[model samples]
Structure formats: structure tokens, C-alpha cells
Target: MLGILVQLIISWLILRFIAKTSMDVLGYRINTTRLLLCVGLLLFTTMAALLAYALRWWFGERWGMNPSFSLLLLANGIWWNIKSVLFEELIFRGALFYLLIQWLGAKKALWLSAAAFGVYHWFSYEILGQPIPMLVIFLLTATAGLVYGYAYLKTATLYAPIAMHFAWNFTNNFLFSGGQIGKGIFVLLPTDTVQVGYIAFVLVQYLPLVLFFVGNYFLLKRFGKVYVGKQHQAPQL
Candidate 1:
């Protein structure tokens, strides 16, 4: 609990500072309400988790897989979900990616930021003592990063990507199993059957990119130009 508290404070302070600095550098004012962004992100993430859970329940029943939920488990699940959303967004969406855009051109920045975010996952594998599987994971994670990077770039707000990141984590961690959601209590597929390094794993990892493409298309249609110049005025909410 102390560790979590420390993480929360450090992440908040660091990201808040970074956000402010990036705003100054880019001359892009924050037009949207931060509270609204937080709420919207929470709602979208909840919806995605519920959708994945419902699907898992349906399939698990068909396949005779037992998925259980209890009060304690539910509490832990929520804690982890919130932790993931807040900390991950602070590092990837809010600070690193935002700074990348300010330093590099937006297009090049996206790839660089995504790679940094994706490769950071190796730390997790090392902690778990799992196989590195560098090549496959890199491609997959990088693809996910691209989708997330593109979203933030287009919206010029951290809200949408943060929400999407939260949703993806919640769904993948506690909803389905294997590539779909994850292998939490709500797991759909038992881990034994799912092999890493297979094409399916790569596809599953990169699935968010497909959503990114769709979101990017709509954003482009609505916004026209993709890059936000320093002199361009921020739109009113």
C-alpha cells in the first residue's frame, strides 16, 4: 500500500509537471476540463471491461470454464485497474508521448514514443522471470503504442487515449483470457493452450492498432489537418 501511494504521488507530480511544460513548449492551451477528461476515461474503460466480461461469461459457460467473482477479488481488481489507468497514462500518454511530440515532429514523435512505451514492458517480463520473446513482443507492443500515440496526437487531449489505455488494460487483464483480455479470474482461455510468439499472439497484441486506425480516420475527417501548430488557437469546448 505504501508503494502504491508513493507511485501515485510520483506519477501525478511528474506527469503534471511534464504536461505543463509541454503545453508551454507547444503553445497549445488545455481547452478541455481535466475533471471531464478523467470521468470520460473512467466511463469508457468501464464499458469496455463490462463488454469483455459479458463475452467471457457467455463463452466460458459454453466451454465449461468456471469464472468466479467475489467481494475481495472485486476490490483488488478495481484497485489494480485504477492503478494501471493512472500510472500508465501518466508515463506514456501524459508525459513521455506529450514530450516526444513537443521535441520531435508529431509523425516521427509517435513512432519514437510508441517504441519507448512498448519496450518498457520488458521490465515487467524481467520481474516475472518470463521469456524475453523480444521480437514478437516488440512488434506487438509497438503497434499498440502507435494506436495510442495517434489518438493523443489527433485529439490534442490526453483524455481519449488514457481512457482507451485503461479500457484495454482492464479488458485484457480481467475480462477474457490469453490474447483477448488476459488470464485473470475472468480468463476465457486456459494458458496452457495459448502459445506465445505465434501469429495469433502478435495479432492480439496489435489489435488496438486497428481501433487506432478507425479512430484516426474519424479524427482526420473531422479535424482536416493532423498537426497542431504552436500558433494555432485551441478550440473551445
Candidate 2:
């Protein structure tokens, strides 16, 4: 936990510096709403986690434990998650996706960024759980990434995607027990425990997230700015 906290602070400072430097280089004005967005998203994440915990207790016969506000108050825990949101936003959203948008174009950048984000989780699956088939989960995660990326592109602020990420993670970790209908660290759901059928397990577990992405494709396309416009147009000859 302390380790996660330290890592998060380092990530936040690094990303903040990067944002400041990039803004100066590009002559792009700073978005003052960034901090507010972060706070709003963090709060939403907390609420969603609590909601999920309530649902699990009501329907799934899970422990009826109230969501821990203390966890959010815990210095390291809060820092770790906040860092998770900030660092992840900085790396995948701020840096990698931004460059990809400049080079490959926005649509391609969005999809490619999503794909890379999904693929990056391979290390977690392989190291943590012995190389399980995580492609399904990754795909869903990628789908979520698309929405997040779109949010960032639309708002030109880190808050939207940050909030969405925090909500999803908090729900998954605290309420869903890291299980959101896929092969994950948690098995809070009924179908998550099937030992023999891995494929069935994955499909049953993470299918909603997949559908969610598919349904949200339009929003992504809309906010993501699929067409290269004057704002991002090539230099005139």
C-alpha cells in the first residue's frame, strides 16, 4: 500500500510536470478544471463502489458490509488509486494517445490506444494468475478505454476519463470484488466460480462490459473527433 502510494505521488508529479511542459511547448492554454475534474471523478468512484456493494449484498448473498469510507481516507489507499488514475491518464491518455493522434490521426489513434491499453494488462494476468486467457477481458477493457479517451478528447480535460476510470475501478475492486463479469482477481458473482469452462466463464463474466463498449461506440466516435479538422489539420504547404 505504501509502495502504491509512493508510486502514485511520483506518477502525479511526473505527469503534472509533463502536462505543464507540453502546454508551454504547444502554446496551449492550461485547463484549470483538471483538479476539479479529478476530485469529482474520485467522488463518483466512491459512490459507485458503495452502490455496487449494496447491490451485491442485496442480491448475491454477499457480506452486507457497508462500503468503507475509511479506505478513501486512508492516505496510501487514496493516493494509490488517485495515482492510478492520474498516471494511467498521463501515460495512456496524455502522452501515448496524444502522440498517436498527431501521427496516425485521431480515429486510428483512439482504436490503437485502446488496443494497447488492453494488451498492457497481459502482464497482470500472466504474473498474477498464471497466464489465463485474458483476451476477452482485455478487449472489454479496451472498449472502456475508448470511452475514456473520448471523454478526454471531448472535454480537453483529464477529469471525465479520470472519473470514469475511478468509478469502474472502485466498483470492480470494492463492490464487485474485482469481478465485473470476466476473468479477474475477484469471484463475487455466481458464474465466476466455474472451474472447468474457462471460455464460458469469461464470456459469462465480462460480456456486459463488452456490450457496454459496443453500445458506447457512437459516443466515442462523436466525442473522439473522428475526422481531422482545422484544429488538428496538417501544416499548410
Candidate 3:
């Protein structure tokens, strides 16, 4: 965490020196109404996707309960998730991304952000050279980056992208116990107990997330033009 803070501080310095921009370029501050709408839109899309999986995988009497459920741990998970989300958003969709737009246009900058995001996850997941897993992980994270970056570009705010990112992570971490964080609200059944075929397993694991990214991508494309008041004034090129 200290390392992340140091990197963030250094990043801020670069953002100031090279871009002449502050964190505001990431669009953290905006009309409260607009922020809420962004959260609502992204959350619904995210939850609907997860719920589709829950219906197929969890609620079919397949996934069981977590024996140990602690409110204290839940609190800790929430705190950690918030910090991690903010850090990633600031890194990927923050100043450097904004500058990429100035140098390259929104389309090219989005691709760069998407590609960097996909590659960064390789180190984060410690899957540096393994071909198969790295490829799969890259595809997933890169697709996510495109969606989130598109949201940022279209809405002119990080609120849009952050909402979607936080939703997917938080739900996976705290609701389904599917994340690296502590125990969540539910747990998946043991593999031995729940025997799913390879095709079913693949669908259960990846399909919903694909639907989510596709849904949000089009949603952002369709309605991201929305804004309210002058609180989120667009950044000048």
C-alpha cells in the first residue's frame, strides 16, 4: 500500500509537470445528481450480469453458504475495495489517460489505456509468462478497460467508469466470496460436490462478464452524452 501511495504521489507530480492538470482531469468532482445517475446506471448493468450467473450457478442449490461471516471482515473488505478502486481509477483513467487524449484522440487514447490496463493485470496477477491464463486475463481486463475508458471519454467524467469498475469488483469480492478479499455473503460449493461439465463451467465463469461489458459499452455509447449543470465542465483540448 505504501508503494502504491508513493507511485501515486509520483504520478501526481508527472500529471502536474507534463499535463499541467490536476486530479480534476479524472472528473471526480461533478454534480451530485449526475454522479448518482452514473452509479445507478453502472450498478444495474453490473448487478444484472452477476445476477444472471447467480441464478444459474449459485441459486440452483449448487453454491453453499460461508460458515464464517463476520461483519468486521466485511467492513475491512469494503474499505480495501474503496481504496483499491480509487487507486486504479486514478492510475488508468486519470491524468495519463487524459493526456493521451490530448496527444492522440479519444479513440487512440482509449486503446492505449485498454492495452496498458490489460498488460498491468499480468504483473498484478503474477501471471507474467504463462501463455493461456495471461491471454484469457488480458482479454477480460482489456475488454473492461475499453468499456470503462469509453465511459470516461463519452461522459467526460470518471464517475461513469468508476461506478462500473467498483460495482463489478465489489460484488465479486463481498457478495459472492469470489475475490481475494475476506469471506463475502455467500460461497461457492466445493468442486467435488458440484460437478459441472467443461462447457457449463466456461459459460458460468465468463459469459455474464462478457454480457456486462457489452451492455455497458453500448449504454455508454448510447446515453453517455448526458450531463447536468456546469459542475462537470468538459476539459479543453
* For every candidate, C-alpha RMSD to the true structure in Å: 6.8, 7.5, 4.4
Candidate 2: count of backbone clashes, pairs at least 3 residues apart or interchain: 3
lDDT digits (tens) for residues 1-237 of candidate 2: 465456445544553564332432111244545455445545544554455445434443344333343454344444445666666766677655555666677677778877877877766455335345576658666877777776666555555677677666655653444532222223343344324366654554555454444433443344333223224532110
Which of the numbered candidates is closest to the native, going by highest TM-score? 3
TM-scores of the candidates in the order shown: 0.59, 0.58, 0.82
- Which 10 residues in a row give candidate 2 its minimum summed lDDT? 19-28
Where does candidate 1 stray beyond 4 Å? 1-68, 127-132, 177-237
Going through the candidates in the order shown, the clash numbers are 1, 3, 0
127-184: candidate 1 lDDT, tens digit per residue: 3344457766676667667766655655566555665676666655654433322345
User: Lowest summed lDDT over 10 consecutive residues: which window, candidate 3?
Assistant: 228-237
* Model 3 per-residue lDDT at 221: 61
The superposed Cα distance between candidate 3 and the true structure at residue 57, in angstroms, equals: 3.1
What's the CA error at residue 34 for candidate 2, in Å?
7.9
The lDDT leader among the candidates is 3
Q: What is the lDDT of residue 48 in candidate 1?
A: 41
The clash number for model 3 is 0
